[model samples]
Target: MSTALTFTTSRRPDGAVVLTATGEVDMSNAGAFATALAGARQTAADTPFVVDLTAVEYLDSAGLSVLFPHVEHLHLIANPLLAPVLTIAGLDDVTTISE
Candidate 1:
């Protein structure tokens, strides 16, 4: 079987969701990214979720596209390379990136 793209999501006792995404999030892994993002959004409705991208090696616009308008808060795990993507997508307003 193909090694599925993976990410870890944890929900705090207070209901905050933290999703740490790793690996490549491209066409091959887009589905997993979408699924994980969707799940995080669903779980974060009450408290908000953070999408940590510190460990992510790559990300496609498709993955970012799916995340738009779906989640309440998206905290990016900061990377100089990827931070610009969010700015280009005009998501800088929607995300909190830690550099």
Candidate 2:
């Protein structure tokens, strides 16, 4: 079964956008995740776009794919459990990951 995923968007005083995700991220909810990312980008086009995955319990390839396109401008905050997955996907080399 697909796990539930929740997304919240917030803007920092400096105009940076933060997209916080909770729960698992898999193919089932990847589209929603992408949509959230797109919205966050549109909200703050020139500033930092942070994806906080600290509360996420899981993330699959589909979710990773959505993140790839935004690597140039995305900053991620993940828990230790998800760190290796992101690193193995080579996301760490492109974007900042704070665990």
Winning candidate number (TM-score): 2
Per-model TM values vs. the true structure: 0.78, 0.93
**For model 1, what is the alpha-carbon lDDT of residue 80?**
77
- Cα deviation in Å at residue 89, candidate 2? 0.4
TM match of model 2 to true structure: 0.93
Q: For each candidate, C-alpha RMSD in Å?
A: 2.5, 1.3
Best by lDDT: 2
Candidate 1 Cα deviation (angstroms), residue 72: 3.3
Residue pairs whose backbone atoms clash in candidate 2: none
Candidate 1 lDDT over residue span 1-99, tens digit each: 333467898976866788887776777777778888888887777556788777776677777777786534676665778878767887777666665
TM-score of 1: 0.78
lDDT of each: 0.73, 0.91
